[model samples]
Target chain A: MRYLTHKLIAFLIALMLAPVMLAPSWAQTPTLNIDVNVGIREPVPFAVPIFIAENNGAQAVATEISRVIASDLISTGLFREIPAAAHISGVSDFNAPVQFADWRAINAQALIIGAVSTSGGQLTVKFRLFDVFAQAPMGDGIQFTGTEEGWRRIAHKVADTVYSRLTGEAGYFDSKVVFVSETGPKGDRRKRLAVMDHDGASLSFLTEDNAIVQSPRFSPNNREILYTSYESGQPRVVLMDIFTLQKRDFGDLQGMSFAPRFSPDGTRVVLSISNGSNTDIYAIDLRSGARTQLTSGPAIDTAPSFSPDGTQIVFESDRSGSQQIYVMSANGGEAKRISFGDGRYGTPVWSPRGDMIAFTKILGGQFHIGIMRTDGSNEKLLTRSFLDEGPTWSPNGRVLMFFRETPGADGAPQIYAVDISGRNLRMVNTPSFASDPAWSGLLQ
Target chain B: MRQLSKAAALAALLITAACSNTGGLFGGNGDGTDVNGLNGGPIDESSIAYFQQTIGDTVLFQVDQHTLTPEAIAILNQQAAWLNANPTATVLIEGHADEQGTRDYNTALGGRRANAVSAYLVSQGVADNRIQIISYGKERPLAVCSSETCWSQNRRAVTIVTSGPGV
Candidate 1:
């Protein structure tokens, strides 16, 4: 009986020790901590097989959707799509599990499988992403429903999801670019406001070529545009609804106003107006029409762009006897010069990320599109040409679009885009001569 | 036939004398003969054509330099005299830049150049009210080539007589 009593006490002690060991040791012990330390410099190998069609009528749409998604991801310079001919397996069923071994054999690190279905004019796209190397799905599968007419946008949405899941950042594929479309010779150039999908698709003119339009900027909400119109014989700032195509002029100010940009809140517009003698920066309330002059010097102060927070303004000024960049509070106050580089800087657009500013720099008889930190350090030039000006930032602050004018009389200006990392320089295709590109925020 | 030839020769001599007195073939001054009417002693050549052709309407500037050169000053002197002669004519000074600078800065530089011309014209006895300034920046170029020759001609301020005899 004494021996049994001892054994019971010992069993109780062992149970208490087991709890302690389980709580501390497992919690502290490190498991296989896999970290993707090296950045994805080379494009990640991905496979986007043709999406399966639930019905016979959905086959064409499925093919087009898969093609668009693959193109979108490929254009980012971060993902490469594996061709169908090289694929060892095909995704025949939407609900079936991904064959990670098949994708791995083809050396694809990521795999995308999708299916398309149409019912009563409604198109549905369902997609799943898998990390082939990990041999499991990366994220939960998603499905999007839209009309037949919006199939491209639906494709872009799937691409955006796959991109965000892989890169851990928001995607910019589902955006639009508004720019000035040009035609005719260099001397008598005709320009009109044009808008297109971010990939240069669905191009449509927003305005006629009756008047000279320039410096188009998208409002934060992407519902309206603020641009300079030479409709009244002098440059005037006007706001127009992007969808309705209706416009309202800023209340009659006495002088010529141009380079209008919306405040972060979209309640105000900051622009440059020439008071017959000198040009200065001014901010006007959209609702009240009250004017506030931000700079009052005898020199020219123009191209006023507000910081992301709307608390500060960065602009180009010649107050220092040469053209340079200056930053000041949103409200009128003493401005501090930010650029001290060798070149003259203008068109200073603050990045949406609030970390850098993109600008056009002129030096040694060449124009360069460059970026610098907000504090004016680490200046990097992305392009060089006869003339490259009017830089506009991408919605995610990862890319910049500007106009490049070729050399000589027939020098047509074309829009070009470059990543902030100084790679993926590409010419944005347009029907004719185009310039002054402005990127809008992601559509709601 | 000899008499007719003599008459033609005399007419030619009169035309040559008239052209020379007006300051060469492409001169700003009108011919000494007041053929176009107006009670004329010398026939005031204060028209816009005279200003553009003879007095010089544009003055070129160095790259990014707004300071007027001596040669530019010489041209402006004649422009000032012509402007002072015609009081009713108001001029628009359009400043332009070469395609070598940023659009915004080039615009600002163009503005400074226009302002400089306006100030100099005012200094040269031309009324300030008679001159208005605009900066086309680099939008309009007289020379389309990319060489220094074309760029020099592009970086200039052109005084356009908007209203008056020129109009």
Candidate 2:
């Protein structure tokens, strides 16, 4: 998905230093599973030492990378970092044998050993995971080579490797998030499109704040973004090359387009189109620029999301008298209403795992971020506040990122993340007020 | 980060809006009151301010409802009359919503409200060519409070007088 204009200096060539790591073993780690009742369980203690720097200029970034890796695991709430001060021994060499007794003395269940080297403008990172309790390496070690500026990505990649190895699920650490950055008071707010690392690192502004923007969604490949822009003085859907920041109107510009999302294959985009009155879902072929109207009704339908398989789409519509979630074939037909027994439901995002749907629900005047099955059963409300909407699933489908706004003159919207179990709610940092967060899939 | 838009330009017209006060009556508090007794731009019946203040340029709607109320219809009726009298004045209708609802649905709801108002103005003999509409949804709020006191005023469609052609 990288465009020609996106001259990425960093190229991560993952080297299989220890060939046994090639096959991921799910049976080795049985301690970490998101499905388990996390409330009753204690966090597994893990330790990551300062990564060894193989050459000059690698020392500072090495320590920073290891710190980020530790931060990533700790933020999940499922893993606890045993501070470096608590460690009995420090790893000074990449190939040195781990002294399990020293780590076990500090009650460290898991250990991360990593090394970094810089040469010819290429930064190389290598890491291995160990189960201190089991007294053995959990898997073989692996290494990655990239440009120096890509150190953060490399660090996240290392974190992802460690997380997936321990959790038996793919890691979301190396992903990007697209959201709207807001400034000014409520009466005269200026919103701009923005992107950042999943951990809120490396913030970048994609557009000037002259126009209002909302609900930016990442394409499956993470190279493009589809969002609604008021730059034309009317709401229109614009597709932008994330690398170049070049944008073009999407679909037929005759009517207003907004709430756009890409299909799993990335060949088509589904979005809501309004002709100054009624709004409906429509799909456009990216290569051909041909548009297909998916819904025909007077009911207001806007938020549209594609299932991971690309065979079904889930969206919110007031067709049933109130805003609710509905699912239909990707080709479009009679959509079966999946959300029931709610104050109202909208912004229904299908999880990448394809088992559940996350949504924004309002009842009793209190807004909530909720999740339910694709068949619309087992609805679980995760977070409740004055206002919470627009839930975007993490790459692993274990967490959701949404926005919550406060009341009064000084009130503004900020992004928040919550787990599916309704535990561990934390605000994602941004330069200013940000909302309508869209989480991207794991980056290449 | 603090860029202003057209709605900010129309701040002079919202003196009597429901939520906040402009400190005092229009032209009396600030902006240099006319000492010669004859003001320019704002006081004329056909002027943007007169149409904005006297004829009433904004129509309010209820929560989650885009269907025009009797009160909204009355305002649109007056707007149509004002537009017909000033043939050279084209109108830009901005539709807005409160922060009570989600973003996307509110946007479409705002659109429906603006369209309903435009349709009413057109039915009353206001030329369709003289009307243009934009939905700000819940993005732009006139009032800062989160209660119904502010919400009611925020959910509105305003008619701004522009010169020449439609926006």
Candidate 3:
């Protein structure tokens, strides 16, 4: 269920943060303001004190939400948290005046304080950001209300606001990833579709372990998931309702269909169907089931992702005699080759920002997760490993999540995330081996 | 001499009856094992297990290449001959790829390999309607290691035979 937005909360105060010019001290870093962005500077230090509970009922949840917010901010590898234990001053009251000297002495560039209350079985959380150097509130205070069961999401929303205000971009903490969870030996591994928070919380399996599910992609709305399942003894694109867990398949076709992805509008799904030795991309209107063949050639064409505006689609095609990234009209037409690198490229996903295309590159027996400009310039490999493929963009397009498999019999695949700048590469937590991650849009 | 000839014909009749009804009972051959080979029981030249074990059922490919190699062609030739001989069996070609590629591309690559095998078998007189194929992609690797040693084995098309109604 969609959590209640902050507007629905009985708010005494809620204000949006304005994007403003950063104070020179923080902006003085060489790459902070540069558009080319090869920045590898020290992480911005921020402080998050325990949110003050307006009543005894919200005491425990307040602390937990604040902690999650801190964790969320720290996870980006962009911000260094000034731990609560080190704070010399606390905001006991929601409207308490801040002591700037105390925060300035700790060298924190920013500070955040919040308060939570319970009313009519609904929990309301309000938070404010402070620019410690300027000694003024960075943004007007904002609050959100939802059921206690949704406290984590509420916390994520708060973190999202803080992150956006500080970084001058959209936040991705409120997103989710749907991936394939694997178990058992490599020969006969059990795979199922699983969904979880971007930070790896609230994981739930969408399909049974016995079914071999592959390449799950989230709808633009985050209400449905499109995945390929071998339940019918052939890979077929299956649509599943995220809430009800009900599924409907495309039924048996002349050939197996796999690697399905939703258009940005969520109105159609594009997938690869193999007819004999040739695989081509086809778009099916979700409402009409009208199948349109986007690419019709004797080559492999799959891993189709749409531009954020839903005007065009970027997919991989080997029509050039080797796998390469290509772009074509969403309505099916000529596709121009975009990848000119010295390797085979596949699994091309257009960034949500529509600026770059992330893809899996194979060269000299090494697998890499890389991105290039939409026009195929300035290609940069973000990661190189024995196996690294299927990069999915975070909501803001600043980070990517992909799977990496280690070498050896004891090795297995795990989910990993990295910023576009090629820093903060960390493994995401999962109960078992996971791969083929598809990130959902930020939750409404 | 006429009486001896009559006794020989009667013995031949008894032996033929035993072979038909009791699977050569009392013939000293002791070939009474089940021929259908249900539950992996006794199997002979016509059994599915014979097709799997004796005739060979897998064809491997090189990295990122689905074009059948000479060794792969030899295996497929054997498989085609087996399928031609055992027309009552159905084939399900399971295509697989190594973990060296992306999921979607590898899946399509697996399909190419399986289709290559199927096209070869059909060309060699195997019925098209009796064969079905599925690409497991890199999802199911024969060997767990990430090295070429395991990848070579992983990139293969395995022909699965099942008992079907007689042609």
Better of 1 and 3 by DockQ: 3
The model with the greater lDDT, 2 or 3, is: 2
Assess every candidate by TM-score.
0.84, 0.90, 0.87
Question: Per-residue CA lDDT of candidate 3, range A1-444, in tens?
Answer: 232222212110121222232232332222122121555478788898899999999999999999899999888888889987788887898777889899988987888888888766678888888888877777567768777767778888889988887777899997789999999887777888888888888777777786788889998888788988877777888999877677897755579899888988888988989965999988998898888888887889888888988989999988888889999999879999989879899989999999999999999888999999989999999999888989999999999999998877877889999999888999999999999899988877
The DockQ values of the predictions, listed in order, are 0.18, 0.50, 0.35
Question: Which candidate would rank higher by DockQ, 2 or 3?
Answer: 2
What lDDT does the true structure give each of the candidates? 0.79, 0.82, 0.80
Model 2 stretches astray by more than 4 angstroms:
A1-40, B1-43, B164-167
Tens digits of per-residue lDDT, candidate 2, B93-166, equal 88889998888888898888888888899999988988888888888888888799999999999887766322
Query: What's candidate 3's DockQ score?
Result: 0.35
Clash count of each predicted structure: 0, 0, 0
Model 3, B19-109: lDDT tens digits are: 3454433233354343323223343565444555556678999877888898888888888887788777787787889877788888899
**Number of the top candidate by TM-score?**
2
Candidate 1 residue lDDT tens string, B14-74:
5435545545434534634333212223334865545665677889999888889999999
Candidate 2 residue lDDT tens string, A1-444? 243223331322222122124325423643433332455278889999999998878999999999999999887888899999888898988877889999999999989998898887778888888888787777668778777777888888888888887877789998889899999988889888878888787777778888889889998888889999988778989999887678888634576778999999999999888877789999999999998889989999879998999999999999989998999999999999999885999999999999999999999999999999999999999999999989999999988999999878898889999878888899998989999899999877
Worst 10 residues of 3 chain A by lDDT: A4-13
